[model samples]
Target: MSLVEINFDGIVGPSHNYAGLSLGNIASASHKGDTSYPRAAALQGVAKMRGNLARLGVQGFLLPLPRPNHALAEALAYDGTEDRALRAAPWSASSMWTANAATVSPAPDTRDGKCHLTPANLVTMLHRAQEWPDTKRMLEVAFGNGDHFAVHDIAPVTFGDEGAANHMRFCEGHGTAGVEVFVFGRPGGKFPARQHEQSFRLIARRHGLDPARCVFIEQNPAAIEAGAFHNDVVSVANERVLFTHAEAFADQQGAYDAIRAAFPALEVVEVPSDAVSLEEAIRTYLFNAQLLTLPDGSMALIVPEECRESAAVWKYCEAMMASNGPIREVIPVDVRQSMANGGGPACLRLRVVCDPATVDPRFLLDEAKADLLDQVISEHWPEQIDPADLWSEALTTQVVAARTALLAALAITELD
Candidate 1:
């Protein structure tokens, strides 16, 4: 199978904003500042998501963490057995990442060097994932045993950190089928900030990459605060295009047109606001970039509620037709709980592996449907009907219920 690498977003324990307020044993809330829902909900969400993926037959992957912080440690530690087949991508996690070169700054004198903390953790995760037979066997074949690490050895200061650089390295290793990174710049995780264009260009050059393939997306209104347009023509020269969608840009189509004109070869797609509400635009954009289908016929979809709304669920279904364009599929997820800090679906979910060929689909069955009828018969009609007969009827009812709920969720959740 062509290597499938997806970033595992919701894989970690439920991630809650703990800017303030606390819920019993769970840490205090940040960013969004809500402390009502227990962290258990997020944890359950992760488990549910994993089961969904596992059932889908997904295995062998890479996880590029937003930040390899203590929170990640806690999340992973919660689920012991640190399997090593999966590699933890360090590009976005390591603090030493600078846009100009791969090397760490501040003269690199201290042990706790800003970049050290996350890289160490990332490497640990990578090692753990690699230890597993599936991930180990596959990765060794792809990058050549340990040869992948050498790509990261180059001290390019351009990409911000080892995590992000490693991500770039993996992309580069893929040759024609390499990765195309779309860095979502906005208010919440505004690492590159307004200089997204400059940052991406510099990072691209440092990595011996063509800027044309890199995409820079500005998704936050606050990042564009003061109404300053950060779109630059120079950056567009490098294929580092900007993204402006109704759900993300306050000026939606205007931003889209601007980006479109800037990079003629770069195709700019319209994002439905209802597909990704203003509050969840950042995550929505990430979902589009990371999980959505690539031009090649494979899906990297991140299906949030927004996709169903503006684009229409049927349209999304149509879009996923696996034609000459890209393989597409809706990622069934809910982000209503995570929208407090201006993030929607993407913010809450992370993509660990993206190669579509690796998806395994065994978990999409309707277990809930089985439970409902069983409950009714056991409670009232226990001796009246044979168990097998009841099961037959229940299975039929369950299928209908599952399909209806899925369609309903898609219809109700959208970018608006």
Candidate 2:
């Protein structure tokens, strides 16, 4: 199997806004009711995709979900007199964080000799819970090759499953067999723990993954209380490298021991709490970065521009890189719009390990496709979206049309 890791980034939707619908996300809450720049956000996302394509040699993208999704609004009785949070739920662009799109077990680890995916039943928040149906629809079309891929329906919503954000894979290489880690959180925390243990167990069974090869680890309650809403917020893994915060797991050493036992070659690069507190880590999203293996075989940490600005985070990054660690380079990109809305480089992408040829041509992104995205997003996406604009009929029409234009451009009407 000629497999490689392809990052499918979500195109920042025209209805992108700072609704602060997520309770555990500090950035989203802090920037609530702020003005959002949809055109700039989408353009920034495209630029990031272009950069990754240049480094990784291949890239893919996921289309934005239909926004101002009045289905939920109508079901909830949207009568203009509803609360602002409830009103913004329909227009929330949280779907741009593709890390929460699904949990995937690549072919190398599955019994069927085919990659498997289960869309997340994100039942934790009303805004996010509505994503699975649309997300599953897109996944079906993108990875429709039955011979290479098996995309399964989401597990029951009774147990919250926030998808790949809380999951990590360990392997010698993208094409090799490896251990999969499912990070579940305990209750009685300051915020609701979205990833349930049962949810991932069901996903593993559905994907036909060996029970012994899958490690169910507990996310640090301290980290979650300190605003690390998802595991990606405090840790990220790429192949054999697990770049994480010292307090990322409930039993940090035990968590390491478990994974290292499963895949002994695990190279862990842990950032201590003294070097950078969990609060600083969450605030700067230092761990919520794309830890990518470049074409040269060296690894790079694609972080947000905010990491560069933070004195503590930048200093730690410089020292770590200077130490000649597994993460050879630290690259920063401008994704401040997404950062404010509570996602970063890793959050914007879904990492699928497979041969690019098996994927639908429409979903694959190339230089020309990147150019098209730049043009369409720049031309059709809204320049500004205020909280009040979510209620505006004209803005809804514009948001809907902008996505339609992009779908038409990509010739991907399956999503529309």
Residue range with the least summed lDDT across 10 consecutive positions in model 2: 81-90
Q: Could you give candidate 1's per-residue lDDT for residues 212-249 as a string of tens digits?
A: 44444444444233121122100111122222344444
Model-by-model lDDT, in order?
0.30, 0.93
TM-score of 1: 0.41
How many clashes does each candidate structure show, in the order listed?
88, 0
Q: What are the per-model C-alpha RMSD values against the true structure?
A: 16.0, 0.8
lDDT tens per residue, model 2, 1-416:
58999999999999999888889899999999999999999999999999999998899999899988889889889899759767988887888999999999999999998999999989999999988899999999999999999988989878999999999999989999989999999878889998999999999889999988999999999998888989999999999999999999999999999998898999999999899999999999999999998888999999999999999999999999899789879999999999998999999999999999999989988999999999998889999998878878899889989999999999997778
Poorly placed runs, candidate 1 (over 4 Å): 10-17, 20-33, 36-39, 44-48, 51-56, 59-145, 150-175, 178-199, 211-223, 226-267, 272-300, 305-331, 335-345, 348-416
Q: Where is model 2 more than 4 Å wrong at Cα?
A: none
Q: Could you tell me which residue pairs clash in candidate 2?
A: none
